[model samples]
Target chain A: MASSKDVIHSKLWQEESEPGDPFTATACYCSGYDVYGELLHKASYVDYLYLLFRRERPLPHVARALEILTIALGNPGPRDPSVHAAMSAGVGGSPAAAALMAALAAGAGSSGGAREVLLAMEVWTRCGCDLNAWQTAIASPPVATRQLVWPDIDHFPGFSPYARDVSIPVRQTLEALADCLPDGCARWLLDHRQAIENLVGLSLAMPGVAAAALIDMGITPEAGEMLTLLLRLPGAAAHALEQGEMGFRRFPFFSLDISNDPGPAMPKEGTAR
Target chain B: MNERPPLETFEGSLNTTMGGCFPGERAVFRGHDLHAELSDSDWIDLYVFGITGRRHTPSQLKVLHAIWVNTSYPDPRLWNNRVAALAGSARSTGILGISAALATSEAAIYGRQIDIAIADFLVRARRAIESGRPLSEVVGEELRTRRSIGGYGRPVAKSAADERNAVVLAIAKKEDLVGGGYLKLAFEIEEFLLSGRWRMRMNYAAIAAALALDIGFSPREYYLYLLPAFLAGMPPCFIEASTRPEQATFPLRCSSLIYEGPARRAW
Candidate 1:
């Protein structure tokens, strides 16, 4: 007998009944909740998303806060590299999933990326809302770990040194989310928003804000990373799909500095090079 | 509904000295004709140029090519390649299969992360050396933190030796490309390990990173350039698995899963 080489384990999820019977799932439990039978009609999608990670249905305010942040991060638009990655696949007629994969890969870095959110969430774990602690940590950032492929944080992951002025939407979203979850870290972030912004010479980017929101919700950094990626996905998916139909002609191609090779110097036919 | 982002949010023309398409006319890549002038150029040359904006000599390009070639392990049991095989097994689109495979290539224990770690270690080592820190002390600090250096150890079931290192270094030697700063330091670390308590040999990624550092790939550039290093092996895995049967890529019997967690119960 060949001994079992791999074993699948999960406390977060399980499904009863095999597929292809009249009722494929007799029941599906998510962290002990009867997902389809009991919680299907009762729970909101955000609540369900919360249960998937946090393993419990959230309080109403927490659900609302997640929804607010979700709406804020839904679509980062075309110029955002994550969205642009998806659009590249769309324009090139590549497979649909490539666009999102491109988004995830491009968004894995520090500049408004998921890893930045992960780092920010880790920061939240270290220093909750203490201005002095934030300052000390920022001034003497820890040496980056070697296990990850992402680059070292040049600036604090949450704060962007390049942002000149805090934009309207970022501030609005922060205030809205903070209002919803007043007792959580979001409020702490809200209270100290300007002070930290002044200290860093700029406000929190979306990832930083999202990190604070996740922390306030009692979400772990690991869970926060997933949520940040999940929340930001709407834009990447929507733009990639839209760009897929627009094709390359109607899009911005050499609008500046028109050249011979939209690929100008074709060798009668393009061969390999 | 939400308000639009500020006008100057990502302002500035998306200009590039890199590549751009002219639509129907021609494509520009690093100030050269994509088709007309550089049609005879090897693909790897064009790729390396795209990364660093500097053309490499044929000798350099050959070693770079070998670095990619030796990594084309078609076995589906490997982590990243399994995604491709499974994608094909499910009859998924090539784009999804390849993209998912590439995405999963950012492994913690191996692959691109290892390259990134090696490059980063080399950089930090150089800086510490420049700042008058002894080489051994820096290595000691890193070893103490990370347990072992990133590219020096492997999951040595059969032998601790890295088989691919010989082939790649041979190409580097054949091309007279062995003499590079980071490469020398990489070997020094390996030598240090050999003499010390942790007797680990240099793996392929360590040398590749050293060569990349010598060949003038800034850590970020090297990171970008090596993103698709395992790309060549994916498509074949996808095709082979897909052509066979649905759900047939390495079929495990249902009983193969030994769930040690909780007993099956109703929700």
Candidate 2:
């Protein structure tokens, strides 16, 4: 065995010692920008978050666009599976951290979740400025090369099939986000929103809008996945706490039918015909 | 092809082959009564049943159980276990600590990622070999593509030094579970690797992945089934740390940190 177990810390961040104390941090820097000395007062939380991922500050309009999207995604509402999962954890009196985790796991799904945003952003990379490519990709999404951690999506990712029409929030976020970046992917999406919606016969949901906006801001699909997971967390956390207070009696529950009957013990070891 | 359903189909309420709970009454797991039918079943066997929808014979279950038992190195120094130990030291909850540790279970190096990669490689190598390609050529193709295979070499220890492989193999042999195609292929590839300039020994992952495939596990099934492979050892680390003073597990001074970041600078 090696005598020492030590590592050179991440180059992305570090802190300065106080004048007399070596243990405590006097200042901190992220990607070489003094977080407390410079960006703390000047940078918005959105800008700081952007720098953490992109390693650079966003332009003014881009920062605004991100903030707008962040607000819209902050709460996915009680009906959304992510928030509902957190609520379930809360009502069950699980550890505080479990609520957030439940939210993340449920929110990372391929349907109207962070995974959808990641997938949609990938589509943006391949089909930039091409409506025809979008149509083909949506009509028949390509298969994953092999088994993946998450199950394969059944419908076009990023769009909301649950919503029969383009919902109010989706339209509002799309239009406002487009104005922030007046000539990019978000703008293109907003301009041709109706046509894009028509192709799927379903509404372009928040993940779809978020995907286009994040891609327009030059964020990668992977980063978009993380961002969506994070931005949507506030709603899950808040709802979890509220549901915890309200208790399980008030919590929404579901019933399932494997069949009309309680099924026979799973065809015991080779008993199945 | 990945067949996707229409939007209309997804809009309907849930349709599941797997069973669910009825609040106060019964709960079903993969169509079996969780409390009644599976109450007496070994957890590992039921876990496999849950994933594969098939129950293993006694010998097969023994081999499968042995795989997990042998790999459960409770030593907190291991990457995934360290997270649990640290969480306990920090006075965190068991659920949070174990979940966090399990989150790190599929890390890029020395985790489920490698198992999945190696399993896929073995499956592909098997296909290529059955289609008349030599084992050596298939391995060479893998080397050319991925540069280094996951299950072949132990980066931390030489092949001769690693202890788990022999023990697990011994258990499998006793159970008569060692003669499967993938296991034979694993040993054959190890021999090929040893004779060549790359003198890599078959590690636990190679053995386990092969055994899983031999036991009728698809690559996906192996991955899912082994999600909590390290779960047994995590709680002990957590419990051990909880007995000590807060933040006492492997406590280090501030000076111990090796910060190679930028030097102090003003705003």
For model 1, report DockQ: 0.27
* TM-score on alpha carbons, each prediction: 0.84, 0.86
Model 2 off-target regions past 4 Å?
Answer: A1-5, A18-21, A37-40, A130-147, A153-157, A161-165, A192-203, A260-273, B1-16, B21-27, B34-36, B158-161, B195-199, B250-267
Q: For candidate 1, write residues A153-219 as lDDT tens digits.
A: 6667787656666777777888998999888677888788888877766667888888889898889
User: What tens digits encode model 2's per-residue C-alpha lDDT throughout B175-267?
Assistant: 898889999898899999999998888888899999989999998889888888898999998889888898878764344455555555443
Using Cα atoms, each model's DockQ against the true complex is 0.27, 0.33
Residue lDDT tens for model 1, B133-164: 98889999999988778788786432277878
lDDT for residue B15 in candidate 1, whole number 0-100: 46
Q: Evaluate candidate 2 by giving its C-alpha RMSD to the native, one decimal.
A: 4.7
